[model samples]
Target: MNNAKKYNIKIAIAVALLLSAASFTFLEKQEINSKDNLMEVLYALGQDYPEHYIEKPDSANIKRGYELIHVGKTKSADGIASKAISKFYTCTSCHNVEREDLDLTLVDQDARLEYAMENKLPYLQGSTFWGIVNRESWYNDDYILKYGSLVDDAKNSLKGSIQLCATVCSQGRELEDWEMTSILSYLSTLQMKVEDLELNIAEFEQMNSLAESNPDSAIAFIKSHYLSKSPATFAELPESKEKGYSFEGRPQYGKAIYELGCQHCHHAYGESDLVLDNSVLTFRWLKKHMPDNSKKSIYEIIRKGSYSELGHKEYMPNYTLEKMSHRQVEDLRAYIESNVK
Candidate 1:
C-alpha cells in the first residue's frame, strides 16, 4: 500500500503509547493532579511543546488535532483526558461515575473473530508493533476480537493491508487524531454534572426489589448511572471561573510568558539533545564545533509552529507563532534568561 496508508496502519496500533509519551515527556517529573490549574497545565505545555505547537496550544492542538482526523490521522488525542477520565477506576469505584468494569454490553467483539482468522494464517509471521503495545495477556482489540468484520467479498482488497499492518507493523485502531481534538475540546469545556453521584448499587438493587423502600435511594442510584464518567464537577473545580496568569504582578513574568508561548518545542529554558544551533552544536557528538554568538539569539522559526514536517522533526508548528505580540516575545526572552545563565 501507499506510505500514508502504511502510516495509518502503524499509527492505529501504538498511537496511544506515542501520544502518552509525547504529552507526558515535559511533565515527566510532575504529577497530573486533579487540583492543578488547567491554565498552568496549558501554560507548561505551551512552553515544552515539541516545537510544533509553541505559539498557542489551545488553538494549535485543537486545529492540528482536527487536521489529522480529517485525513484519517489516528493517534492525536488518545491521551486526552476526555477519553481517559481517570484510568482503571469504574463508576463502581465510587458510584460517582458508573459501574465497576464497564458494562460488557457496551463492548463490540468483532475484532476477535478477525484475530482468530489470522491465527489460521501460515504466512502471517509475527509483530514488533504488537510487542510494544500488547500486554500479551489481554486480547488484541476488545471490539474487533469479539465481533467479526462485516466486510463483503468485493471489499476483501482491504483485508491484506489490514492483516499486514497488524502482524508486521503493529499499529492499532480506535481513537483517531481528530477525535482527540474533539475530546480535548470536551475536556476543556468540562464542568461536573451530577452532584450526589455515587451509587450504593447493592442498596439500589435492594431498594428496587423491595415493596416499600426509600424512593430517594432508588432515585440516587438511577441518577448515578447516567454520570459514570462525569469529570470532577464544575462546582468542585475552581476552573469554572475563568483563570489566566496575570502578567503584571509576577516576578517571573518571563517564565509565565515562556510557559504560555515558547517552551513547547525549543530548548529555550534548557538545552535539549534534539535541537541544533547555527554551528550544529550538540553536547558531545559535535564536540569541538564553534559558533560566534556567545549570546543566544532567539528567533521564531515557526510563527505558529514548533517544528516542521517539511523536514524538521521539531514538532513545533510554525505559523502559530506569527500570532504572538512583541511584549509576549520579550517576556519569553526574560523567562529563558533564568535558564540560559
Candidate 2:
C-alpha cells in the first residue's frame, strides 16, 4: 500500500461516509467501492507501469513537478518548479517501472479487440491523438537503455528530451524559453514517466528543432538511443542514404502504428474526440493508460498525457502484450520514415 493508494483509500472512505445516509445509499456505496477498486487498480497499474507513475518523493519539489505534469505542465508552472526542486528530475526520468505486475497497457491485438468489444467505449479508429506525444514517449522508453532512464540522461543534456516530453505530457507546457530551458535542465534527471510523455506537436517540434541545430549531437542521440536496445547495427548507413530519424518522422510511423495497435479506443472516425494533438500520432486516451507499448512502432512515443485541448477526453484503456512482431513493426517504421503525411 503506497501512500497514493492509502490516500485514495481515505478519500474513498470519506466519500462513502458522506453518502451513507443518502437515498441511493447502496448504489453510492457500490460506486464508492468501484472507485476504490479503480484507485487500487491504478496503484497496481502504477506498479505495473512503474514507467508512468511516480511514488511521491520525500522532496517537496519532486512532488510538485509530478503534480504539475499531472495537472498538465503547460498548465502549472509553480507546481512543476516546486516538485522539480525536491525530486530534481524531469517528466521522463522517473516514469518507467520494472514491476510488470499491475500495468494496464493495451497494445496486444487480441486484448485490444476484446476491450473494444466489451466496453461501451469507442476510440478504435484512427482520428484522435497527437503524434508528437507518443513519439517522444516511445523514444524515451527505448532511450532507457543508453541513458539508463531519461532522468539520468536529462542530467547531462538538460535540453533535448526533457523539454519536449514536458511540453507533451502537460498538453503544452506554458514555460517561457528560458523557463523551459531551466525546467528542461532539471527534467533530465527524472526517472519515472518519461515513457508516458504525450505525443504532442509542441514537444516533438522542440526536440526536432533542437536536433536540427546540432546534427552531430542529433546523430549521437539517435546512435545512443538505438544502441540501448542492442539491435544489430549496420556497419553504418551512408549518412546520406536516408533523410534522418526524428520526431516529425516518428508521427508518420505513429499514425499507422496506432491504427494497428491502438485504434480500439482511439479510432479515426468516431463520436469521441479521438484525434492526435497535432503532435505524435498515438491517441491521447491510450498514451496515458499504457506507457509501455511494445506494440509501439518505429519512433514510438515514450511520454504520457496532454492538456485538455490536445487530449480533450477522459477514460484510459488497458492493452497488454508480452511480445510483438518486429518485422511487422519495422514495416510500419519504414513507411513512416519514407512517407508520412
Candidate 3:
C-alpha cells in the first residue's frame, strides 16, 4: 500500500479504539449508578422493616413471636387487663425500624421523606434492630453500670434484657417464659447479612455544634455531606408553607417532627391498644384533657415540659430552643391540629 493509504487506515483504527473506550466508560458508570440505586432501596427497606429483611426459621410460634415483639402485647391480653394499663410501650418504640437522618429544622417536608426513603437520612437515638441478634451484649451505658456486663449466655442474656426493658423502661409486668422464648426466636431473625450505611459521626457532631449558633447553615452542611445531595436541590422542590407560621408549618412537616419526637411515646397510629401506655399523649387526648390549651400552651409544654395536676413532672423531656426552635413547635402544632379527628 502507498504511505497515504497506510496513514488513512491508522487513523480509522485509532478512531475505532477511542469509540470502544468511550462506550466502555459509559457502561461502567451506568453500572455503578445502578448498583448504588439498588443499594439505596435495599437499605431503606431494611431500615423500614428490619424484621422482614432478616432471615428466620419458618414456624407458627416464630410468627406469633414476631407479632408479639412488634405489637408489645399478645392477643390474649384484653379487656380490663388492657384497660388498666394506660400505655403499651413496646420494643419497637425505642428501637425504631428505620434510621432518620434529616435535620427537620432545615429540610422541607417532602424532601425529608424522599431523602429518608432513599436511605440518605439517619435516625436519632433509636438503635436499629437489623443486627441485634449478633450483638454479644444487650443494654449499653447505665444498664451495664447497674446490671454488670450483659449476661454471657445468649438465652439468659435475652431474657434478662427483656426483663429489664419490661420492668424498667415500660414499667410493666414481666414477660412469661413462653413470651420470652417466642420473642427471642423472633430476634434471632434479625442478624445482619451485610454492612449497613451509617451517618458520618464527625459530620453529625459538627452539625450539632453549629446548630446552636447557625441552625440554618448547620442543616445545609448535613444535607450536603450526610445526605450526599446539594442543599439547593431540596430548595427546588415545591414549598409547603402554613399561613400563620414563620416556618413551613405544613401537616407533612409536622408529621416528620412528630415521628421523630412524639410518635414513639404517643402511639397515635396502628392498634392504639398496643401502645406502651394508654395515658401517652395524642392529639385527640390532648384536645379533650387540656381543652383550654392553645398553641402557646403547647409550645410552652414542649419547651418547658409539663407536670401532672399532682405536681409530678411528666415523662417527656423538655425540648430546649437549641434542639427545637419556635418554628418547629409551630410545625408540631400544625401536625397535631390536622391529625385530630
Candidate 4:
C-alpha cells in the first residue's frame, strides 16, 4: 500500500477505537444510574412492615414520604421569616442520612457529639436519625420521655415538633396529614444500615471541583439531584400568608438573619460554645468581648469572617455579598444586639 494510504488507515483505526471507548464509557455510566435507581426502589420496599404488622406502609407512599422529607415545600419566599416557605430547606436540611468527609464538629457541637454517641453521630444536618425508628420519643432532649406526652402535644410531641419546625425553622405552613404520614413512614425506615454509612467521597470530590468553577451551578446540581431522587407527592400549594418573621424592627430582622445563617453554629441564645465560636459571637458574648459593639465591626467580622490569631481561617464560613447583602448583615447585627441582656 502507498504511504499516504497506510497513514490514512492508521488514523481511521485510531478514530474507531476512540469512538468504541466512548460508547463503552457511556454504557457503563447508564448501568450505574440504573443500579442506583434499583437500589433506591429496593430500599423503599424494605421499609414495608412484615405480614404480622397490622399497619404497613405502601411502597409508593413510602417513596413519596422520602421525597417529602428531602424536598417538599408549600411555597417559596425569601429572608429569615420567609425561610420556612422556601423550597430549598426541608427535613433533610437538619436531619441528613448521608455521611460526609468534612469535620462538621468544627462548625457545630452536634457533630462532636458523634464521638460520644457512636453510630449516633449527627447527620450532615448536625443530627443523626440512626436507630430513630426504635426511639419511642424524638428530639435531642426527649420531650416525650420526660414530659409523658404523645407526639401531638405541641413542641413536645413528634407532630407538634414537626409543625414547629415547619413554621419556625423552615418558615412555612404546617405539613398536611398525608405529607406527615409520608415523612413519618420514611423516618421509620432509618435503621442502622452499615452499608449506607459508607461515604461517597467521589461525589463530594466532584462537587468540590464543580464548586471551584461554578458555585451556583454546583449548589443547583446538588439540590436537583436530591429533588429528582424523590418525586413530589403533592402539587405546589398556594403560598401561605404567614410571614416567617414578625419584623417588628431591625433587631427582629437581624434575628431572622441569625436564624437563617448563624444559628447552625451558634445554636440557640445561650447554647454557644468556644469550639464552634458560638460563645464569642453570641449577642451577649460579642458585646463583652468586642471592644466596639458597633454594627460596622460586627458586619466586618461576618463579611470577612473570623480567623485565629495565628492567621488560620476558622471553620466558620465567610458571608460574602453573594451569600448575604449588606442590609441583611445590618439586620443580623440588630438581632445580635437584641439578644443582649
Model 2 over residues 1-341: C-alpha lDDT tens digits? Answer: 38995586455434433322223221233111211212122232221322322222222333333334322232233443322321222332223211111122323433433333344323221111111111222332333433245444343333444443454332334345544433322222232222232324554454344444654453343223211211111121112213323213234434444453444324344222444332434433333333233323122331111213343522221211122233323333444434323
For residue 267, give model 3's deviation from the true position in Å. Answer: 6.6
Backbone clashes counted, model 3: 15
Q: Ten residues in a row with the worst lDDT in model 3?
A: 229-238
lDDT tens digits, residues 1-341, model 4? Answer: 47985576455434423322222121233112211222232223233332111134454445555555644532211221112233335565555544322332122222323332344322222234433442223333332332244334443245665665565444457776766665565554553221232327676565445545665554443433321111111111112212212233366545545554455545433222432233435457654533343322444355444322343322332343423444554555556566665
Worst lDDT window (10 residues) for model 4?
229-238
Query: Candidates 1 and 4: which is better by lDDT?
Result: 4
**Across residues 115-194, which tens digit of lDDT does each residue of candidate 3 receive?**
54366333222344544543334554332333344323222354676676665545457776656666665554443222
lDDT tens digits, residue span 1-341, model 1: 48986686455424432322233222343433233322233333332221112222354354433323223232343454333222221111111111111221122112221232234211111111111111111112221221235222112222232222222222223343345443343222221111122325565345344313443443343333432221111111112112212322222544443332333223433212334422322322222211112112233232222322353322321211112333334443444433432
lDDT of 1 at 139: 18
Off by over 4 Å in 4: 1-54, 74-88, 98-126, 139-156, 192-341
Best by lDDT: 3
Residue 310, model 1: Cα distance from true site in angstroms = 5.5
Per-candidate TM-scores read 0.23, 0.26, 0.39, 0.33
- Candidate 1 ranges beyond 4 A from true positions: 1-251, 259-261, 264-297, 302-314, 319-323, 337-341
